[model samples]
Every structure is written in structure tokens, then in C-alpha cells.
Target: MATCKSSSRTGLDSWQSRKSLSECLRHSLENKMFTDVTFKVGREQKCVQAHRLIVSIRSGVFEAMFYGPLAEQDEVVIPEVEHDIFEQFLRYLYTDDVTMDGASVMGLLYVSKKYDVKTLEQKCLAYLSSSMTPDNACVILEQAHVFDEQELKEKALSFILENGYGALKSSGVTDLCHECLVKIIQAEELEVDEQAVFEAVVAWSESACRKQNKDVTDENRRQVIGEVIKHVRFPLLDQKYFAKNVVPTNLLTDAEKVKILTHWICPNENVSPFNANKRTGIIRQEKIIIQRLAGLCGFGCSCSSGADHGIMFSVNQNASLQGFQLYGPYDRPTAHYDARAFITDPTTDDVIEGSSVTKSVSVAAGTTTYDVEFPRPLKLSKDKKYNLLVNINGPKSLYGKSDRSTVQDGSFVCSFFNCQKSKHSNKLNRYTDVDEGQIPGLMFLV
Candidate 1:
């Protein structure tokens, strides 16, 4: 989709026409019909010439940004673009366009790059370099790779490959990371072999293990990757998933169960020499899985009460990595869980209040998570902490109906609990039966 030239803003026309580079620039600039952009032109490889330009809404400030001529630059591509590309195109209007929005300048820079415009591309790259991020760096670096933008690609590769020989580790697989990796390992001669990369990963893993005095396995490596992913969250999980057929009688395999268990539990022993080798994640608190599979990531084994015992499982990975962790192990039966969540007022045995600890508050039970809203913008608050207390009703699809069927009966009968016993949180009232849209049978206990 990025490679295809088009504008994101609707209701605007693309600066179309397959005119040669010079023709487009001359026409766009002489008449000032599209004057809000910078243009670049240069010859290279003798026969293959170059003409680059930038179009952005914020080009003036960009051209005057850095000290002297900024060295590092990347390209932005907005095909058949609109005003969004206007600012970057404005930068290419001159050699040293520094005063621009470094953050929002990529797409237009890509456009300049597509036309083989060099100078403006360098300026944009410089802006990106001055203010680098794992996300953005990965992006422009990828642009460097695609267009053989050596200098820009190298700049991005340096950051990703830094932190003491981090070649083997899979960093975030963003569009930027994908491009940068391709560029960094473009040729075999300039690359470390896969075995070497493996060795590097092992070496790094071993170092981490020694520091923690823990066993590091292939599983451990995957876990580290998972941790990194938590910090650099993916905004793409909402992608539609094609359902796979499954047998109704199917139970989770040991390996699948373990994968789930470790993820939910993150069980680790403090290999730290000074501290006792205590299990890292076995606290007696319950948590709710509100995100992944809508609650499929949670795992619990219970054989309590009377006849047929059931194991409950749920998975929820909120946009943030905070509420996601491993659950109690399979070997352990009937475990207790207390997790971080937002629930009934922790203090009062009365009604639930609007100022609950949950990131999301909803008016209705059985609501799809997308419908819930965090009272404030979704952010973790250190002052007030809350948790979810769920009884394992077990094995339900997020929207019910397992892989075998569309309608599912296996959902949780969970409850929210407020653990905020602190002073600053006096305003929060206990959530209860009277709250708008509260369900009937479910009681909001004090």
C-alpha cells in the first residue's frame, strides 16, 4: 500500500501527470500552484539521473532545523500525493531546509525519494537522524534499503544493531525495521552468517542468564523478544484473522499448554546470588485477560468443590503489555490469582463508582472490549492500582464459539475488584448494581 502512490487525506487531488522530474518541478514551482514543497535534482550513474523533492504541510521550519547542512536524511513517499506531502516537497525547494516537523515528514520525503531527489532526501534524513527512534529510524532506514540509500540505511542499522551486538535478536517487525533489516543484510559479504547470528544471540542470552542466575533456553530467547515487544507495542492486532477449523473434542496439547502457561506465568527463579532463588511470578492474586483472544491467554487448573472440575483459561493483551503475564502452572491444581485490574470499589462494600481503577469502564456486561472506554486516555496510573478476580468458568472463545463453531458457551464468570486502599483515591466509589447498564445476577460485593 505504501509503494502505491496515493494521498491519505481524502477530498484532495493528486499532483498527477507522468511528466519528467524537471518538468513537474518547473511547473509546480514557477506558477506556485504547488509551492509548499522543496525540490532536488542531480545526476548519478551517468545514464540514471536523480531528481528529489519534498512536500509537507510543515516545510518552512524544517528547512531551517539543524546546524548548517544536516547530513543524515531519509526519503518519504506519498504517491500521487496531496498536501500532506507538500511540506517535504517544500524542503527540497532548497538545499538546506531544516525547519520542518521531523516526526511527520516521512511520507513526503518518500515521494522525493521516488523521483530520485537527493538533496531534499538528505535534509529529511538529517532531521530523522537528529531525533531518532526505534520506530522512525527503522522506517527511513528501510527507505534507504529500497532505494540503495547507503548512508541513511547505515544510520538506522547502527541503532538497531547497537546495545552490544544485537544482531540475532528480532527487534520490532515494523515497516521501518523490515526495511532496515533488509538493507543492513543486503549483501552476504556485509553480513554475519546465520550461525554467527545464532552464536551472538546465545552469547547475549548467556550473559543475561548469568546476571540473573537462571536457565536460558530457546524459549528464553523467545521470551526476551516478547519483552521487547511489550515496550514497542504493535498497533496491528486488530487485523482480521481467518478462523481455522478445529474438533470440538480437542484439548490443548502439552506444548501448546506450556506455551500458554509460560506466557501467562512468566515463571522465573531469581538466579540473583544475593536473593533467595524464589519463583519470580507466583503471587496469590487473580487477573483478567481482557485483550488477547478476548481472554484466551489465561490458564488455571481447578478441581475444587464437587464432581466435574474445570480448568479456566483466558488471554488478554491490552494495547500496553501491562495486564499480560503468565498464570499458575498446570502441575499446580486449584491456584489462587490476584491480578491488576479495575473493579468494584476496593474500600467500600457499597456501589461501584465512576473513578474505578480499571483502564476501561463500561455500561454493559457482555460488551465487546472495543466498546469499553477508559475514563481518561488509556494510561497506567501508579497512585491507584486495581485487579480482576475471576473464577475459572473455563475454555471459552473471546466472542464465544471455539474454533469448531461460531457460537460459544465457554466464557468466564469473572468479577472486578478494587485494591486501591490509598488516600488520593477517595473520589472512587464502589461499582455496583445501580451503575448504568449493570447486569442483574452479578453482584458487586463490598
Candidate 2:
């Protein structure tokens, strides 16, 4: 009984000792007690204090700097690192803890990497991953490239591609380096139209010209962009839009414009230098069949008055919405109808811009499926509810049964909710939920 009591007392003392040491170290760091080294940091050369032994013990780079054969100076100069950032780095060494947010995390990451502090570096990366958004992705990608952080670079690139429109529009895009900008424009998986890509490149060119101390003229803009402009996929741009918008600008040469026009006229001929291949995000479509219809029974939804009929659904992963598949007339072999499709954020009650497509569709005989495609792939974020509404002028069409609310296809999962309908005069101003509606499946690319 004496031996057991002694062992328990020893264990309790050890735990208390460890707790006391941690508190003492934290207090020492806070008070700058027994600090043996001084650092002149940042362009202003502000002085900061730290303990050499604690810093060396925590960081291999500091150990080498302080104890290696070249070790001599008690004072270190780091003109590139800010004073507050150095303080954060020293605090981590002393307390093994860090407080970071979006604004300070990047600086902390740079300092941690310089000092070979693996734990702090990883913590910074984890913070960045959680807080990444389209607005800052370009800036993050540029910094990741500078730091040679391959994993962070890839993550930033993926986020930019997934949210191409938002990222391109962000002011941070102009801050990207030339090589990084080229990589982004050349990516086949980028989910934005070629016109948007062109506009982003133009914006970058203007910024680059200003940095080079050159006038922001058409010639200077073209010169700054250089070879990056070749990746714009000029042939993929709409012919009318290209003629009206692109031709007016001096960015493209007469020869280049002629080549693009020739390709449009004779698409089979490889005359243009630019790639005509459609971005995979636009062409590689996958259909999520919420419910397949047999075309045996006519859908009961009223379609003659040109009322909008649709469904509300959300995707489990980031994707581009291509369009939707709706059924045609039940008995008629062929029919002509004016079809319009658009998507809206049901939460905000605002229609997503560039999502609306209107065209006259002719449903051929022997086919019940009518494909209505958007003018461009609409960007859809993961787990956000969007209403896909289509208005068709025709008679009764075939419909399907909705036995399940959720359907999983490979890496993609789509969940369907209530059907939505709106009259032509009100036209998406408001939607009334219908118990039964007629959208068969969603066409998309993940």
C-alpha cells in the first residue's frame, strides 16, 4: 500500500511539473524575459526580442544559424519579414501555439517555412485551405508559386477553375504572375467562357503595362500579354460577339482575325492557330436522371399557355450546369415549340446572369427526349439549391415518377425537392410549388 501511494504521488508531481514549465515558458515569452537575441525585421528594421535556445530548439534553421560553424552574431537582420510576423514566429517557438486569421496566416506561413517550422507551416496551410475563396484564390496561387508549395498551388488552382467566373472578376487576378496567368488560361478544365477568359487577360495586360511603366494603350496591352493571348481559344468565341467586341480592339492582328473567321466558316479545316476544342467543362456533359419516363402516360402539367415549369435541386459536388432534359408531346411524332431555360438561386430569388437561353426547338419523330441547352455552362456551387425552370409552348408531354428524392451517380449526388411553376406575365418573379411537375433529368459536368 505504501509503494502504490508513492508511485501515485510521483506521477502527480510529474504532471504538475510539466504544467508549471508550460506556464513559465508562456509567461517568459509574453514578458520578453531572459531574451538573448534581437532581430531587425522588415523594411523599417524594427527590433524584436527572442530567446536563442528556445528558437533553436523549435526550428532547425534557427539551430543551424545560431550553433553552426558560421554562428557569430547575436543580432540577426531580416528585411523581408515584418516585425509582427517575427513576433508571431517567436511566440510559436516559446509556447508551441499560434493564433492566426486570413490576413496574418500567409505571412506566418512564409516565416514558418523560412525557419523550417513544419508544425506551424502545416497549421498555416490548414487555415488557408479552410478559408480559401474565389476572391483570394488568384493571390494565393501566386504566393504558393513563389513559395514553391505544390500542394497549396494545386488547391488554389482547383478552386479557381471551379469558380472561374468569380475568380476572374476578382481584383486579385491582376496580381498573378505571368506564368501563373498562362497556366490558368491554358487549363482545359476552366469553367468559364472564352469571352470571359479574353476579358480577364485584357485586364491583366493593362495591369502588367502599368507595372512596366508603359502607357496602358492597345499596343502596350497586347505587348504585355505576349504569348498568353494565344491560349484564348479565339475560334470558340461566338462569331457575332467576336466580330463586334474582339475586332474593335487592336489586341488581335488582321491575319489572326481572318484565321479565326476562316475556321468558323470551314470548321473542318485546321486553318486557325488557336485551339478550337471546346473546354471539357462545356462539352463533356453527364446526365443525372432524376427519374426516367416511359412515354406511356401524358404529363398532366399545363404547357399550352407557355408557363414556366421546373424543379428545385442541389448538387453534392461543384459542377457546371449544362441544361435539362424534358419530355416532348406524348402521341405526336414531331412538334415545334419555343423553349426557354434558366436557373435561379431559390434562396435569394435572383436569376443567375447568363443562365437564360431561349430558342425555337423542333422535336423530331421517334424521340421523346427534348434537349434544351444553356448558352453557356452555368456555374453551380456544391450543396446550394438552384431552380432549373423551362418554358415550352406545346401540348401535353410525357412525364416520369419521382420515387426517390436523391440519386447518386458515381462521384455526383443530386437531390430533388418540390416542383416550381410561374406564369408567363410574372415570369420567374415568384414560384408556386407544384406537387407534380415535368423536368425529367439534369444535364451537367462535374
State which candidate has the highest lDDT.
2
Candidate 2 Cα deviation (angstroms), residue 59: 2.2
Where does candidate 2 stray beyond 4 Å? 1-19, 72-74, 129-131, 286-446
* lDDT, candidates in the order shown: 0.33, 0.77
In TM-score terms, candidate 1 sits at 0.27
**Residue 1: error of model 1 in Å?**
32
Q: lDDT tens string, model 2, 205-226?
A: 9899999999999899899898
Best-fitting candidate, scored by TM-score = 2
Error of 2 at 404 (Å): 15
lDDT of 2 at 30: 63
